[model samples]
Target: MKPGKVKFPATKKGYDAATIKDVLPEGAAPFRRRLNQEVDITCIEEGFYGIICTPHDDMGMVMVVRSGDDHFPG
Candidate 1:
């Protein structure tokens, strides 16, 4: 859950946000090591899809998808 204003989706409060990237405070690099990952999904229905992450995390190999074959351009 993020510590700030702005209504989040999912939970009633702001406890329904995804942690996309992890940008720690400056000079705090010794706390945790950085890693990369991705998520795959198949869209059964159409609505809203979201990709959330912490600040400062690099954008590589990360994917939040809506499952469906119709979404593809063939």
Candidate 2:
């Protein structure tokens, strides 16, 4: 793999990342990897701020939108 390219799973799934153990049942191993990977992926995604698990999108994935909200309250 290249220095920048991460060799994630080559499955049909969009993003292949590792899930953390203990949080999920032993049977649901395929979907679960590590929460850290989600964080990394989320950071790369757009319209992202925070997330709340809902419906089929339980991971709480968010799309970060580049709005004019960068102003800090001084």
Candidate 3:
């Protein structure tokens, strides 16, 4: 997902911090997603990204995304 290429639409809930340290790739900036609004994300780095809704994080409102091809060693 290139920078500003991917769009995240918040139809039901919004995200407070989209990129958490250690979980997202380096240089990935944390962004917010307002309710009923859309936001763009930068996933140019090849790594795992963790997205969470600050207010609903305790309720298990979280997601994980992998930006690159799976190249696990055999």
Regions of candidate 3 where Cα sits further than 4 Å from its true position? 1-4, 13-17, 70-74
Residue pairs that clash (backbone atoms under 3 angstroms), model 3 = none
Tens-digit lDDT string for candidate 1 (1-74): 21222223332222223423332222211121123422222323432233343332254423343323324334
Candidate 1: worst 10 consecutive residues by lDDT? 24-33
Full-model lDDT for every candidate: 0.30, 0.30, 0.67
After superposition on all C-alphas, the RMSD of every candidate to the true structure, in Å, is 15.0, 14.2, 3.3
Write candidate 3's Cα lDDT for 1-74 as tens digits.
Answer: 44434577766654454555567667666566665677777677776677877778789978877777734337
Q: Global CA lDDT of candidate 3, please?
A: 0.67
lDDT tens digits, residue span 1-74, model 2: 11121233334435434433333222322233333233322222122132222222556553222222233236
**Which numbered prediction scores highest in TM-score against the true structure?**
3
